[model samples]
Target: MKTALSLCLLTMALGGCGNIAAVKSFNTPYGSPTSGDTARLRVIADGMVRAVPGKDCVDWYSPGAGVIAVPQKGFADRNGESLGMPKGATAMQGDVVSEVLVPAGKPFTLHFLDGGRGSYNSVTNCLGMFYFVPQKGADYEVVVHGYSACGVKLQQLGAEAPVQVTKAEYCSAMANF
Candidate 1:
């Protein structure tokens, strides 16, 4: 499992992970701007693969696709849409956060950016994907802990009464990832 995740991450680091140009089909053009009210989203996506006690790894596949978001109308597409996170664990991984503007008021599925491998030898350790709805004008912070599990966690980082997060505060919070 570790080897697979490592390979995926390596591919991503080498620019082999699914890229916008690598996808042959699409619901919209690659890198198209949000079509409606958009909210800023900050994500700390992780691609680490951890071993769970007594559980066989089912997601040992290759081609880490970085982070991906698909609207309800679009099928899975391989592209480097996530913030810059590496394929495996490294001291520099903390720097690989992503911020993007996505359509608000719609539910989108989030996929692991590191799951862009061409095929799979197993199934359990498959990358985790989740759903989210971004409120118009609201900003969100999400943390993706690993690839082999559904560790996608999120919180609203903005204050309702117009409070801005300080660099110190954000840096402190990011350390948890």
Candidate 2:
């Protein structure tokens, strides 16, 4: 379900899918994704955004921490998908959230990012860029967002250790992890 959706045909823009496929965490700050750096493997940010190691969780969604980042470029005609905050298939519970932190038993490693968006012209797909954490109580390991189809996806990257995401889903923009 890793789609760049800028129209497809990328093995990282036509070079490789080589097949190392390893991830423990990443949103950066030393918490995963490295055999010393394997070129980002096309970046879809696995399992709550992975690239883990040990304690490298620096600052996930920082600005004001009320957390919401959806700087759109193409939202696939407003329905394909984008990480804004409005697009409804299942509508995803409520509040549009994702806040996570992992280390106890390791749920695919952990870090966080995700806001919310989708306009549902029947659901297409296009996603990238947008990070938010607006700055409240701080501890925001996630802030989540949702909208996806076919391959199914949802966001909110785990605000701080709350697992169980199947095709990806989010709703909880942050009031306190």
Candidate 3:
């Protein structure tokens, strides 16, 4: 009886050791909108990306609204090419291409998690939070990269350069507490 109890406790403890956080699926309104009050934002992630609603910054420890993006399977084979990685960066099997609508001129935040090897008990997992304001009727793309050190870049679709974005200020403060 004692051995069985110990085994059960061990299983429970190990179950919670993974680096990935539990998040719901974020749902965008059906039918693409052509209004100037909204903008299209594409999220590309090798692991997963969570869209946290509201302008306020949220920390990593806290759960967000839900996961908005995940890695796409067989995307590279379908396209027969890569989806444009930054110079000196290695490409994953397939990056997730998820599009969603965001309020124009409003602040939006995203939490990025690296698809590190081994979902459970992974030491290479990295997390990053970034916020940006979208312009009306414009399309934007957010690319997330890295494992041990995650990086996020935002750029307007068809633009040659990436736009400047800052990390969530609240997350830093929360870390101090």
Candidate 4:
């Protein structure tokens, strides 16, 4: 009984220890108002991934650590390339920007790579997934933010108050991604 209680208390205490907070959404969406063009995606990466020097950030996605934000469907195509690592060295802090050209006119899932024990999130732990659809002629921004125990949380930000809330929902379809 004592051991169980100790473990519970420890978990509660460490719950807020590590967190990826204040993920700023982009100030402007990319591109102009074009009728038949694909929507541009501005992914602001703000989270924890056990960064290993000299390894492609995508490599860390396996069992250990890495940070990623990409389209939830058709992630890999043409050349079988999936959206994972952003285009630069993994920075332990601050925002890393990466853009993807999404076919406009519909909604899509955004996947965030929330790693294992290394992340240190003790609440709701798992892959952080959410739903978002891009608007034609406008850029869409999403924040990949979370720690291990907290799993992952995707927040869509608006330029002003009453931020338009993009449906941050989950579905069985995620299993297909």
**Whole-model Cα lDDT of every candidate shown, in order:** 0.41, 0.26, 0.57, 0.37
Per-residue alpha-carbon lDDT of model 4 for 116-174, expressed as tens digits?
A: 43534454344444444555555455555544234333233343322143433333332
TM-score of 2: 0.22
Whose TM-score is greatest here?
3
lDDT of 1 by residue, 1-177 (tens): 898787668557645565432332222222323366866666555442111111112121211212233322233422234543223222234324545665566553344434333245544344653455667777766555543444555666645332222111111322211
TM-score of every candidate relative to the true structure: 0.43, 0.22, 0.59, 0.41
Return the candidate ranking by lDDT, descending: 3, 1, 4, 2
Q: Give residue 127's lDDT in candidate 2 (0 to 100).
A: 30
Error of 4 at 10 (Å): 33
| lDDT per residue (tens digit) for residues 53-164 in model 2 | 2222222232212212122321111111232332223423332222222223222212233322334333432332222222222222232333343221333333433323
Give me the runs in candidate 4 sitting further than 4 Å from their true place.
1-36, 46-95, 117-121, 124-126, 148-158, 161-177
Task: Please give, for residues 136-176, the per-residue lDDT of candidate 3 as tens digits.
Answer: 87778777865544677788877787877767655455321
Candidate 3 ranges with C-alpha deviation above 4 Å = 1-36, 59-64, 72-92, 118-123, 169-177
Poorest 10 consecutive residues by lDDT, candidate 3: 74-83
Ranking by TM-score: 3, 1, 4, 2
lDDT over C-alpha atoms for residue 50 of model 1: 16
